[model samples]
Structures are given as C-alpha cells and as structure tokens.
Target: MADSTQVFAILAVTLAAFVWGRFRYDLVALAALLASVLLGLVPADAAFLGFGHPAVITVVAVLVLSRGFERSGLVDLIAEQALRVGDRLILQTLVLSGTVLVLSGVMNNVGALALMLPVAIRLAREHDSPPSLLLMPLAFGSLLGGLTTLIGTPPNIIISAYRQDLVGEGFGMFAFFPVGACVALAGLLLIVLAGRYLVPQRAGQASLDAMFDTAHYLVELRVPEGARAVGWSLRDLHQAIEEPVPVLAVVRGEARHPGHTFHGHLRVDDILLVEAGPEEMALLEDKAGLEVGPEPPAEDGDGGGDEAGTVDTEGLQLVEAVVRNDSMMLHRTVGQLRLHNQFGLHLVAVARDGGRLNQRLRDIRFRPGDVLLLQGGEGEIGESLATLGCLPLASRNLSLGQPRMLLVSVAIFAVAVIAMVLDWLPAAVALTGAALASLLAGVLTLREAYQAIDGPVIVLLGAMIPVGQALETSGGAALIADALLALGRDWPVVATLAGLFAIGMLLSNVVNNAAAALLMAPIAASLAEGFGVSPDPFLMAVAVSASSAFLTPIGHQSNTLVMGPGGYRFGDYWKLGLPLSLAVMAVAIPLILIVWPL
Candidate 1:
C-alpha cells in the first residue's frame, strides 16, 4: 500500500495533468504509471499487463466490427431508407437520431456516429438545413445510446469489467439497457422538440450544387514526338487527366473541336487542344512539358467571383472537402508532399474537425479526417485528389451494384459478437476473423480493413493502460474516494452518486473518456465500500457520466467529427449541451437508483 502523502501527491498530479490539455491523457497516464513504479507502489512485471486486458481487446474488436458494418454499406442503406420517409426537419431529426441511438446501443457509439455522419450531412444538404442543428443531436443520441448497453461505449465496458473484478460478477449484456433506454428516449424527445432553439443556427443556406463551384479554364499541353498522346483521340486524353476535371474540348491547328465531336487521332505536330486553366496548365507544363495557350478574356468567368464583383473563372477556383480517415494524404505536411508542385493545387485553408488553422502553412501536419478548403484550377483539382486517394465531396457517378456479399459480412460480424459475449472465443480473435471474412467476401479489401482502424486512438489506449493500473495499485483512487466521503458524510447515497457522476463528466471534458472512466471507476467503487453499499450503482453512474461528453469538442470523437462539417464554434456545443447534460443528470440519477438499488 502507498503512503497517504504519496497517494495524494499522485492524485493531484494526475488531475492537474488531465486538465492542462498540453499533453495527451494517454501520456499522462503513462507518466503516472512510471511514477508509481518508481515509488514501489505497483509491481514492475504487472505494470504493462493492462495492455492485454479484456477491456482493451473488447474495445479494439468493437472498432473493427464497426468498420465492417461501414464497408458493407449497411448503415448507408439504412440512412437512405430513413431519409425517404420524410422531409420535415423535426420528423427527419426524430427518425435519423432515433435510428442512430438504437444502433449505438448495440454497437460502439463511435462507430454509430461515423456511420450516421454522412447520412446527416446528406440530409442537411437535401433540406437546406445547417448541419449544426442536426449534428449535435446526433452526437448526443450516439452518446445516449451507449449508456443503454455494455458494449455501447468503452467506458461502460471498463466499468463493467472493474465491477466483475471487485464483486465476482459484473453487469449482464443488457443489464443497464432499461435505464439507458428511458434516458435516451427522454433526451431524444427533448432534442427533437426544443433542440433547434438551443443550438445556434449558423449553417448558411446554400444549395450543395451552388456551394462547390468549379473554375474552368483553357491551356495547351505539348506532346513529345514519341509520347502516348501522339496518335490518341481527344477522348483518349480524358482517361489520362486526373479527377475533378474533364477535358471539355480539343484545339488542334487553329480549329477548336468541341468535346462531343473531337474523336480524330493526334499527329506529331498537332498542338493537342487541351482545356485547363493557369493552375492545371502550370502542373501539366511542369510535369509533362505542356504549353499554356493564350489566356482567355477575364470576363467570360468560369464562375469564380472576387470580392470586387469581378468573376475570374480563368484565374482560380476554391473547393472544400472533408479529409477522410482512409485518405493516403494524411500526416504529410503540405511542403513535404509538394501539394502544389505535384498536384497543381494549392492548400489554402485547412479546417480540422471544426477548428480554424492559424498556423503557418508549412507547420501543419495534415491529420486524417480534417476538412480542407483547396484553391486551384477546377479541371485538375479532382484528378489531383484522385491521385492522392481522396474522394470528392460531390456525389460519385459510379453505381452501387447489388451487394450479394453483404449477408456473408453480416453473418461474420454477428458470430464474432456472439462468440465474444458468450466467452467462447477471445474478442480479438473474433474481430480478426470478421475482418478477414470481410476481405474474403469482397466487402472490403485487405487494405481497406487495415485503413479502417484509427492508429492514434489504438496507440493512445495501449500506452495508457499500464499507467491507469499504476494509479489503481498506488492507492491514488483510494485517496480521492476517501476525500469525497469526508466531504459528504451526511449526504444521501443518491447525492454521493450524483457527485461521482458530475466528477466523471467534468473529467471527461478534458481527458479521453476511457482514461477518465478507468481513473474514476475505482474511486467510485471505493466510495461505495466506505458507505457499506453495493458498488454497482456507483459504477453505472461513472460509466454513464464518463461517456456523456457533450460540453466540448475535444471531449468526444462524435463532436469532433462534426465540427468542420457543421462549421460550429467552440462555444456552440455548450449552448445545447449544457441543458442536455443537466437533464441527463436529473434523469440518470433517479434511473441509477431504481435500476441498481443501493
């Protein structure tokens, strides 16, 4: 056992580090763990064992299974069907949010949010509604749904595992679902009825078609005497140019061939009538030695208008795209990737989740899932993005064929979840099997499955597990629990539960939810023991509170995911979230008492 002073010191430092925001919670946990080891509080051999714990494996497996659901397009199909049911804003929110909430109860909340986000974006586009109003509700719904099931959120799983260790039995698969369902239903009703009034209305009213304007321009590329373009028709050039831009016309020997009739083969002296603007022309000229044709008149504007009311379509075009996690272009700095030199497009502004980029252009290391506002020639932008393994924001012309293999993917996932839940197989083995099955079934490729996992989150979790164990073994949790008990000796059990819930919620705002839950669960358990009550209620409180992170962008992945797309401000979350959180507390406290009696 650690000395009281040592335990207090550790708790203080951990809390301070968590609130600082300068260091990641995982690193802080690791640091605390190392301190405990050096202080002789935890055994060295057992220090790193948390990485292999069941909770960790369960979380990872859930993430993988979630990815399979996404790749199979099952979620998208559901979203499409739901949207076709109505056009009323309130009705749409009710249906979409309710569906996501129900799905999240059975799957990972993060996965549920990821699956529903595109659908929400599509709905916002269709209704001309700002995503801001809809996204927060969806994020809240996802969080609420997680409260309903053991596997809904990582924090819930961790708390359940901790309970099993302490009392020799943990919550059953649907043990908390009744309470969670009521809470989710109440919250969903509040959002659908009055959420729009609370959440700010900031999404501009712009048609999706009008928002993404492409600048068209004309330029000429010279074909070497022996190059592939020497004898190819203008239609042949279409395949060579990258996406976002297509050749509209061909100019050869002073005669401009409209794209529709330009089918003749090219000769050695033929100046291939290429259609590209300054940016596209510059890239091709530099890369393939293409020549720029005479500049077109400034007023024939390809549609880009300046602040001075002059449209200069020939000059440049601005486009916006959200960076997908699967994008190969992530993590590379613009200068290192030579975005302009290689792709012929300039990186003007980078919007991360929803935060602004005030940093120097060279200093920004592009993260996966960042939204970018790019500027360049319209014709070449799409092609450049394709080369970078990115999908355009605009709908693709490709058709979704009948997915005959979706049933196989679904069966594999269902079996994996059953095996893990039933304790017949390790969670990791089940998920790995599911991922492999997805690849074999052609639902997603091996490369796609690998890309589905978020590396940073996995690394952060692995590195922090040892640290969380150190805090537990070092008696840090005991010290904090004792302090809370001292302050509320005469308070009711419900009050104590509420205090624990509030503390967990506050901590989650600053630190990762998993780390917050791991740190707080033991403390809540200690408090329960001090009061001579069952720890189950307290543990449930911690689970629900840790996952209800609606106050800040950094608190939850779902919140961060919608930031850039919704164009929300930092303060916007609290406007809707504060009341919602309070309501959750009011409803959840009573539910916890009734569901898990003290």
Candidate 2:
C-alpha cells in the first residue's frame, strides 16, 4: 500500500505548476524530480536513468534524419511540382494536403509543413485567396500525417518503447499503418469537404495588373572615363558589386545589350548598363571612384534638380521582414552579425509581436518572431538577403546554389536508420555517427546541427522522465487506475478505453505529449488488469489520444508557429480544431477496438 495523501498532493502541485505557465515546464519537472528524491519516492541511483532511455535516443535520431532530408532540398523540389498543378481551390487543397500527408509519413511532419508553407502562400497569392483558408488545413494535415509510422511522432516512439519494456516486444515499422492510414484518409476528406466552410472567407479578389508591385525603384548608372567602371564590362561590374542589385542593361554609345551577357568584356568609353537605386549607385560611385550622368527629369509637380543633379531623399523607402523561426539569423545581434558592414544594409527599426521596438539595433538579440525594418538600396539588399537567410517582403529572384554533399548526406542518414532498424547498433550510436558524418562531409556544420534540434522540447522530455518514474514508484499511477476502475466497474471495455483516451488527451494539451504518454501508459496497463482484459488496446488508445492535441495553439509547436503568420487569435483554432478533435476521437475509439481488440 502507498500513502495516497502524499502522492495526490504532489500530483496536484505539479499540475498546478504546469497550468501556471510562469516557470518553464522543464525546470518545474526538475524541481518535482528533486522533491521526489528527497521524499525517497524514487531511488537516487535510478533517478537519472530516464535520460539514457531508448525513447529519447529514438526521438533524437528521427530529428537528425529529418534534418538531413530537409537539407537535401528533395522536399522543396516536391513542393514546386505541387504548385504547377494549377488546380481549383478545393482540388488544390486536396492535392497539397495529400502530398503533405504522404511526405510526412516518410519524414518529419514539421519539416514537411515548413517545406509546403511557401508553396501554400504562393498558391494563395496566385489565386487571390486568403491564406487563412489554406494554412489551417495544411497544419492539420501535417498533424494527421504523423500517424502513419512508428517514427512519425514522439508520442508513438514513447508508446512503442514503453510497450517493449513491458511486453518484451515493440511495434514493428508498419504496425500502426493500417489503422493510422484509415484515420488520416478520413481526416483529409473532412478538411477537403468542410474545411473551407470552417475557415473565414476574408480573401477578396486581386487585380491582375496589380499582381506584381514595383515597390523597388529602377535607376541606371553610367561608367565614367579613367575609372574602374570604364575598363569593366557590365557582367564584370555586376559580379564585383556584392550587393542585391543586378545589372539589367548595357548601353554602349548607340548599341545596347538588353539581354546582357555575363562574359561580355569591357573597354574605355563603354557605357556600363547597371541597375541600382540611389543608395547602391552612391556606394558604387564612392567605391570605384566613378561619376553619374545627369539625373532623370523630375515629376510634373516637383521642382527641378540642382546643377549637380541631386534627387529628393523622400523618394527612398524602407521595407520590413519578420525573422522566421527557421531563419539562420535568429539569435544573432545586428552588430555581431554585421548586417550593415557585411551586407551593405542598415537596420532602422525592429517590431516584435506587433509592437514597435526602440532597443539599440546593435544590442537587440534577434529572435524568430522579431520583425526588422531595414533601410538600404533596394537592388543590393535583395541579393544580400539570401546570404543572411532572410526572406524578402516582396518576391525576388533567387539563386539555387549547388547542392554539394547532398548525396553523401542522404547515404549517411540511410545507413543510420538502417542500422537502428536492423538492431545492428543502438539508435543513439547510429544517430551520433550520422551527425558527425554530416559535419565531416560538410553537409551541415556543428552549429547547424545544434540549431536543428528543439532545445526546450529535449529539456522537457529529460526532466519529466524522472518525475514520471517517481509517480510510478510511489504507486500514484496504480492508485489513479484503481480509482477509475472502481467508478467504471459496470462499463464496457470500449467505454473504459474511451475514458482513458479522454484523460490522455487532456493531459497532453497541458503538458508535453511524451511526458503524458510515459505517465499514463502504466496506469492504462493497470486499468486493463483490473478489468481482466488485454492492455494493448487501452495502451494504443492512450498513445493516439496523447498525440492528438489540436484544440489550442499552445498544444503543439506547429500550432504556435502558424499563429502569427496565419493571423490567428487564440480562439480561432478550436473552430475547425474542435470538430476535428471530436471526429478523431469518435473514429479512433472504434478503430482501436477493431484493430487491437480487448
């Protein structure tokens, strides 16, 4: 017998702390673990064992493999093809959702979603449609797709590892595929048919003429005599100017090459056809010691220029870009990163979460959600933006760099997954080897590998494992299971399974899904024993429910990520999400009973 009072008290306090949200979940979990150790609820020697658990290794391995797939640009290639289908809104949704579902089954759903997002935005812009209608459906599709495989989501891995510890065997690679596929198909159908109605139709029609906005200015630069520009051809000058601007034309006295050649040679008196705004033109003139020709005529209402041909400074404009979570510039400060010195762009202002920021630009640490307002010559800014991993407010031409080491990255990742699946090596060893190989082969740097992993999630998992073990050792799980069984003595096995599923779903919404699964699995087994039935169905029910957290933005990282971009309020999610959640519950309960019968 266990002291029920002490166990319940600890449980209450932990749940309260999680709901508070003031402290980090990992730190709270660690505090709980230490408290348990002090109370002698868990053995001190066994306290840290969960950090070395197989589930953790499997999760880490899956993350690394997902990163490898993303770096290969295979997902990007697929998304580009999806964009070319030119399907109707309904048909486009079906195609995009279906593609993401299939791709996510083979790779990480988050990676799949990230690759598809730009395509979704592009489609929305093409059709003059609101992204609100498509983005939520895509996010839901990514979540549903994770059900198709064992390594599809962290919850699945935790459940499978837990099962192995209890029953001496784990789920096979395709164990969950049949039922999961059915659920995913049904979910996809619902979103395709009814999702449009659920989402607001706020997208008004856009004019064809206004499709491409000329927010950037176009100006011409002239090469001066006895200057560096005099000896350089347009192509050489374009390459030498390491800014965002491009050389659009080359005017040589009476002759002009509108379709400029990159290899064209230069000589004295050659009028270099260069395209740049005032800022870049100024920079070029200063750097190469060249001079500009007479300025173009002023507007009808504006006063004429001075003898030296200076234009109004008011014509210059600035644009802002929000730094996305996936941006390489996330965590760097403006000065440390040297945006101005290296890229020839100046940071004028930054906006965070819709609020104007006044922090010193140099001292401001860049986070994923921060928006930067920059002032620079528009042409050079666009090209330099690529090197900084920043997306432009307007669509600009992009250069797809050579995908060197892509094949080596794929091969190494394949070997790691194969080694783990074949039981030839531990998953941790395989993934560690693959991460190192990627670095050695120059597929990803060590810094990039670290950046790819979600630190908060890892910490939450590591800290909560010890706390979950404490709950089990203190007989908390058994007590809760017994109480539930007593209350539902007359209920059918399916009803008991449903109740367990509901509890798991609730717990996952509040805490981390892996932690919820680890804490609930043993209790589910105890409940099955009390009812004199197989525990497999009940455990599977818990597993599915734990991973199905679609109600709130905070329930999943994907939900949180789309909140800002989709312009969604906290309540907007449950409009479509509530129905989806209920549908999953209704379908999943029956499927669990049919597939793994009690």
Candidate 3:
C-alpha cells in the first residue's frame, strides 16, 4: 500500500510537470525516472536497461527509415501527380489527405505530414482556397494513418513491446491492421466528408509574401550628395538613428553588400534597405539627412535591381522558411547564431503565432514553427536552410534524391517491409538492417541519418519505460485496475473497456502519446487479468486511445505544427477534432472486440 501511494504521488507530479510546459518533456521524464530510483521503487541496475530495449531500437531505426523515405523524392513524385487533379476542393482534399494517410502508414506520421505540408499550401494558393480547409485534414490524416501500422506511432510500438514482455512474442508488423485499419478508415472518412464544413476558415500563411507583408516594414533610404550621413560607416549611420530599425543591406553601383559585413563608409547615391516603420523612417530621414526613395526595381534575370542601375540588389534574395522542432536556430538569438558572420545570411524578419513579430531581429529568439525571412545568396540559401534544420515555405521541386536514387531507396524500403512481414527477422533487426542499408546505398549520409533521430523522444521512451515498470511491479497498476473494476462491476465488461479507452484518450491529450501508452498499458493488462479475458483486446484499446489526441493543439505535434500555417487558434481544433475523435472511439471499440475477442 505504501509503495502504491508513493508511485501515485510520483506520477501525479510527473503529469503536472508535463502539462506545465515550462521544461522540455525529455527532461521532465528523466526527472521522474531518477525519482523512482532514489525512492527505491526501481532498481538502480534496471534503471538504464530501457535504453537498450528492443522498442527503443525499433523507434530509432524507424526514424532513420522515415528520413530515407523523405529524401527519396518518391513523395514528391506522388504529390506532383495529385496536383494535376485540378481545383476541386473535395477531390484535392481526398487525394492530398489520402496520400499523406498512405505515406504515414509506411513512414513516421510526422515525417509524412512534413512532406505534404508545402504541397497542401501550394494547392491552397493555386485554388485560392483557404488553407484552413486543407491543412487540418492533412494533419489529421497523418494521425489516422499511424493507427494502421505498428511503426506508424510510438504508442503502438510501446504497446507491442509490452505485449512481448507479457506473452513472449511481440505483435507482427501487420497485427495492428485488423482493428487499426478499420478505425483509421472511419476517422479518415469523417475528415474528408465533414472536415470542410467543420473546420473554421481563417487567413492562413498561405503564401510566402502574404505571411510576412515585408513591404510595410521595409524602407529604402537614399544618400544624397553632400548629405550628413555620406562617408559615414554603416555602424555610424545605425547608431545615429536612435531607433531599433536595422539596416538590412546597402546597394551601390550594382553591388549589394550586406549591412553587417560592409565596413566601408557609406557613399552618395547608396540605397540602404532598412527594416523600419513610419516613425523609424521619419527619424532616419530627419536625423541622418537621408531621403526615402522607391524600392530598387528588378531587371530581367536579376532578382532585384534599381532602374537607374545605381542601386543593384543583386545576389541577395529573401527566402521564407519555418524553424523545425529540431532546428539549430531554436532558443538561439540571431546575434548568437552570428547569422551574417557564420552563415552569410541576414535575419530580415520573423513571424509567429499567425502574426509578424515586432521585436528587434537581433533580440528575437527562434522557436519551432516560427517563420523567418532570410536574405542571402540564392545559390547557398538552400544549403543553409538544410544545415539550420529549417523548411522553406516556398513551393519548389525537391532536389535531394533525383531520378536514380529514388529507385534505390524504394527498393531498400521494400526489402525491409518484406522481411518484417515474412517474420524472417524481428522488427528491430530488420529495421536496423534497413537503416544501415540506407546509409550504405547513399540514400542518406551518416550525418543526415544521425540528425533524423529525434533525441528528445528517444530520451523520453528510454527514461519512462523503467518508471512505467515500477508502477506495475509496485502493485500500483493492479490497485488502480481494482478500483475501476469495482466501480463498473454492475455494468457490462464492455463498459469497462470503454472507460479504460476514454481515460487513455484523455491522458494522451495532456501528455505525450508514447508516455500515455507506457502508463496505461500496465493497467490494461491488469484489467484483463481481473476480468479473466485475453489482454489482446485491452492492449489494442490502449494503443488506439493513446493515439487519438485530436482535441487540442498541444495534444500532438501534428496539430501544433499546422496551427501557425493554417491560422488556427487554440479553440479552433475542437470544432473538427472533437467530432473526429468521437468517431474514432465509436468505430474502434466494436472493431477491437471483434478482432481480438474480449
């Protein structure tokens, strides 16, 4: 009884920390694992064993394989085909969402969504459709597709591993298809048929220029002959302005110099591209004796140039890109990154939370989903974005894997799937082999493969697995199961299943889905034991419910990712998500019973 009480208290604090959103989830999970060990609930020797567990290995391999799929250019091929279907919104939704759905089953769901995001935005721009109508369905489809395959989600993998420890054999690659495919199909139908009318339309960041609206913030200042600011260094000009406006670049005689690197004195007729508002522009003109002028016009084949050829903004182009969750820019200020000195890129502007940021560029720290407007050489910008772990918002053909490597990557993936289905090798071994094969075949480099692994998620799984076992071994799971059973004693056993499923679903919304499964799986096994029924149905219930985190943007990364691009609010999700979640539950319960037999 004391053990159960202690375990409950530890879990309560862990869940609270997860919901607080102050610290990283991996750090929170690690803290819980240490607490369990210090309290003597989990042995010190066993505390680190989860790192080498087969589930953790499989997840890492799957992430690498997902990266291979993304770089193969196969998804690009399919997206190009889907684009030819014309402008009918329903057909576009079906094809776009359906493509992501199928891809998610084979790759990581988040990776699947990442590949389709730009394509969906392109579709919205081409058709003049509100991105709100398409992005949510695509995001939701990725989640539903994860239900169909074991590797589709971390929760399903966790549950399958737990079943292995209990029954001496883990679930096969296709074992989840029976119940998961049915539930996923039902959810997909709901998203396609009703998602259009249900999801609210908003002014999303549908286009590159539309999102930043840089025209409002940018001003061109011309240095006239004998002007007070003439012959002054760019630093002196900025220091004299007395405002926060930044000089982005200086154009002189067809040569555009980045403001940060130009140490020479400003020359007459030089046009300074400054990021400023009305007040700052006024201050610059009044204090610096500079006059505002029209922006440099673009010449054919020259991205941006002046008509008189005095100010030629050549070689510098603005590229809008979003910071990914694993971005090197995250939590780092522009000054820290040394955008100009290190990467030869200038931070012109940033947008977040569906609006442009008003903070000074140097003071603003990057965050996931924050859209950044960067200025650099067009030739090096794509390479810089890849290095920074950012995704460009502009629609362009993917250049990584071309005509020949596509076939190589596809062949490698197909072989791995065949090996898994035939039980020629265990999932972890086969997937690991595939990942190594990808590295050997030049599908991805070793560095690229390493970057593909989500370190935080791996940490969360490795740390939480031992803590979850402590809960079961300490009798905490059985005690909770007993209380739930006593409450539902008068009701049918199916009602108990429903209650367990609901609890897992709600828990997943508040925490990571993988963590939700780790915590709920033990109780599910306990419930099945108490009822004298097979645990297969109960475990299936946990897997499906844990992945149904559709009610809030914070419930899953997919939902949060689409929030800024789709222009959705905190309240907008439940409009479509609530009904879709209910449909999943309604479809999943009956299917679990029939497929696994309670």
Candidate 4:
C-alpha cells in the first residue's frame, strides 16, 4: 500500500509536468524514473533495462528505415503523382490523406507526415486554398494510419511489448490490421467528406513573401560616392546602427555578397539588402550616411510590386525551411549557430505560430517547427538544410525516379515485413537487419541515419518503460484498477472497456502517446485480471485510444509540426479533432469487441 501511494505521487507529478509544457517530456519521464528509484519502488539495477527494450530498438530501426525510404527517392516519386491530381478539394484531400495513411502504417507516423507535408502545401498553393484546409486532415491521417499495424506507432508497439511480457508472445505484425484498417478507413472518409470543412480558413505562412511580409521590413540602402559609409567595413557599419537591423546581402553592381560573411569595406554603389523597420532604416541613414535606394524589382512569378526580398539572383537563393524537432538549433540563437560563418546562410526573417517574430534576428532562438526564411548560395542551400536538420517548405526538385535504389530499398523493406509475418525473427531483429541492409546498400549515409532517430522520443520511451513496470510491480496499477472497477461494477463489461478507452484518449491529449500507453497499459492489465478476462480486448482499447490524440496541437508531434505552417491557433485543433475523435471511438469499440472478444 505504501509503495503504491509513492508511485501514484510520482506519476501525478510527472503528468502535471507534461501538461505544464515548461520542460521536455523526456526530462519529465527521466525525473519520474529517478523518483521511483529513490523511493525503492524500482531497483536501481533494473531501472536502465528499459533502454534496451525491444520496443525501443524497433522504434530506432523504424526511424532509420523511414530515412532510407526518403533517400531512395521513392517518396518523392509518389509525391509527384499526388500533385498531378486535379485541384478539387475533396479529391486532393483523399489522395493526400490516403497516401500518408498507407505510409504511416509502414514508417514512423511523424516521419511519414513530414514527407507528405511539402506535397500538401504545394496542393494548397496550386488550388489557391488555405493550407489550413489541408494540413489538419493530413496530420489526423498520420494518427489514424498508425492504428493498423503493430509497428505503425509507438503506442501499438508499447502495448504489444506489454502483452509479450505477460503472455510470452506479442501481437503479430498484421494483427492490428482487422480493427485498425476499418477504423482508419472510417476516419479517412470523415476527413474527406466533412472534416475538411471544419478546418478554419487562415492565411498561413505558405509562401516566401506570405510568411514574413518582407516588403515591409526589407529595404535597400545604397552607398553614394563620398558618403561617410563608403570606407566603413561591414562590421563597422553594424556597430553604427542603433537597432538590430540585419544586413542580409550586399549587391555591388551585379556581384552579390552574403552580409554575414562579407569582410570587404563598403564602397560607393553598394546596395545593402537590410532587414529593418522604419525607425532603424532612418537611424542607418542618419548615423552612417546610407541613403534608401530604390527597391529591387521582384523576380518572375513573384507578382512584382512591393514584393521586396523575394528574389533569387543568379547565384543566390532565398529558401524557406522549417526546423525539425530533433534540430540542433533548438533553444540556440542564430549567433550561437553561426549560420553565417559556418553554413554561409543568412537569417532573413522568422515566423512562429502564425505571426512574425519581433525580436532581432540574431537574438531569436530557434525552436522546433519555426519557419525560417534563409538566404544562402544556391548550390549550398540544399546541403545546408539537410545538415541543420531542417525541411524545405517548397517542393523539392529531383529527377523523376531512381529505379535501382528504389527497388533495392523496397525489396529490403518487403523482406523485413515477410520475416515478421512468418515469425522468422522478432520484429526488432527483422527491422534492425533491414536497417543494416539499407545502410550497406547506400540508401542513407551514416550521419543521415543517426539524424533520423528522434532523440527526445527515444529518451522518453526508454525512461518511461521502467517507471511503467514499477507501477505494476508496486501494485499501484491494481489499486487504481480496483477503484475504477468498483464504480463500473453495475455496468456491462463493454462499458468498462469504453471507460478505459475514454481515459486513454483524454490522457493522451495531455501527454505523449507513448507515455500515455506506458502509464495506462499496466492499469489495463490489472483491470483485465480483476474481471477474470483475457487482457487482449483491454490492451487493444488502450492502444487505439492512446493514438487517438486529436484534440490539441500538443497532443502529438504531427499536430505540432503543422501548427505554424498551417497558421492554426491552439483552439483551432478541436474544431475538426473533436468530431473526428468521436467518430473514431464509435468505430473502434465494437470492432475491438468483435476482434478480441472477452
């Protein structure tokens, strides 16, 4: 009893931390594990064992494989096909959501969503529709797709591992197909038919100019003959400015130099591409003898007038990219990253949560999902983005296909699936083997493979698993199970199942889905024990509901990834998510009963 009380206290604090959103989830999970160890609820020797758990290994391998799929050019090929479909909203939604759904079932859902994001944004631009109309549905589709396969999502994998510890056999690779497929199909229909309408229409940062409204801030300053600034170095000029105005580039006649790296002294006719508001623009002219020059004409297809700073010169490019969750830039300011010195990229402007950041460019710390407008050498921009762990917002330009590599990657993935289906090897071993094969086949570089693994999520899974075991071993799970069982004693067994499902769904909305499963699985098993029924139905309920985190942006990384790019506020999610979640619950319960009967 005492141990259960302590474990309960630890979990309560952990859940509170997760909801507080001040610290990372992995940090919260690690704290929970350490607290349990200090209280003697979990032995110190066994606390780190979860790091080596099969579920963690499988998740790591899956992430590497997702990157392999990306490098093989198969995903890009398929994206090209998706773009060819007519611009009708329903048809576009169906194709985009359906492709992500199928891809999510095979790869990490977050990764799958990342691959499809550019395609969805392209569709929105082509149709002249708000990206808000498409991104939410695409994010929701990623969640629904994960329901159909054991390896489709972290929750399913965690739940399967829990079952293996109990019964000595985890669910088969396709075991989730019967119920999961039906639920996914129903959810996709909702998104295609009516859910798209629920998405609020907002002007997102869908285009280069749309993101920063750069014309308002980006101005040109020319150095006239005999001007006081003519002999000033770029560094000296920077010291003269009062406000944090970044000089993005310097055009001397036809030659363009990146301001971040320019060491040459200023000269007459030097056209400075400066990011500054009116006051700073005035300050530069008064203090440095810099006069505002005529705005540079917009590039073709830029719709000209007032679209300053939206041009690509002969050798220079302005690209928009979003920082990935695992980006090195997280919590690091532009100065710390040395974007100009190391990568030769200039920080032009930044947008987050539907608004432009008001801070100076160098002081603005990068966060995951921040859309950045960068200026860099045309030849180096693509390589720099990959190195920085950012995804370009624009569609990639690639040759149509690389048949040989694509075939090899697909063949390796197929063999792994076959091995899992035949029980020739455990899911972890098969996936690990497939990842190795891809590495040897040159599908992805070693650095790319390592970058693909989401470090925070791995830490969360590794740390939470041991804590979840402590919950069961200390009987905390049984204590909670008894209280719930007693309340539902008069209800039918299905009602208990429904209650468990609802609890899982609500909890997932506030925590990581994997953590939600880790915390809920033990209680679910205990409840099955109290009812003297097989744990299959109960575990299935927990798995499905945990992945149904559709009510909030913070509920899932997929939702959060699209929040800035889609221009969605916190409340925007529930508009479509609430109805889709209810639809999923309605379809999942009966199917769970029929498929995994008590």
Whose lDDT is greatest here? 4
Please rank every candidate by lDDT, starting with the best: 4, 3, 1, 2
lDDT of candidates 1 onward, in order? 0.68, 0.66, 0.83, 0.86
Per-residue lDDT over 427-488 for candidate 4, one digit per residue giving the tens place of the 0 to 100 score: 99999999999999988889889978888899999999999998899888999999989998
Worst 10 residues of 3 by lDDT: 301-310
Per-residue error (Å), model 3, residue 161? 0.8
Those runs of model 1 whose alpha carbons end farther than 4 Å from true positions after fitting are 1-25, 205-304, 307-333, 336-348, 352-360, 363-370, 374-403, 416-445
| Candidate with better TM-score, 1 vs 3 | 3
Per-residue alpha-carbon lDDT of candidate 3 for residues 332-432, written as tens digits (9 for 90 to 100) = 88767877657767777787766777766657878767778887777778778878878776677745457677888888878888998998988999999
TM-score of each: 0.76, 0.70, 0.90, 0.93
Candidate 4: which stretches are off by over 4 Å? 204-209, 213-216, 225-236, 239-244, 295-316, 326-332, 362-368, 379-389
State the lDDT at 512 in candidate 1: 75
Q: Count clashes in each candidate, considering only residues at least 3 apart in sequence or on different chains.
A: 7, 6, 0, 0
lDDT tens digits, residues 1-598, model 1?
4454675577579768866645555566677767767886667887677777767776766766676676666676777777675568888789878989987976777678766776777777777777777878888889889888777888877877787778876666677787788888888998899888987766552223333333322344456566556666543453454322334345566765544345688666555433344455554545444454434456554533422222233323555666544345667777678775577665645655455554555568775446665665566777677556443443332223336655776788788778767877654566667767777778776655665555545555655566555556666677778889988888887887899999999888767788788778878988998899988889989988998888987787777666667667678888888888888889999988988899
- Which runs in model 2 stand beyond 4 Å of their true positions? 1-11, 201-442
Who is ahead in lDDT, 3 or 4? Answer: 4
Off by over 4 Å in 3: 204-208, 223-248, 258-265, 279-291, 294-316, 325-332, 336-344, 362-367, 377-389
- For TM-score, the strongest prediction is 4
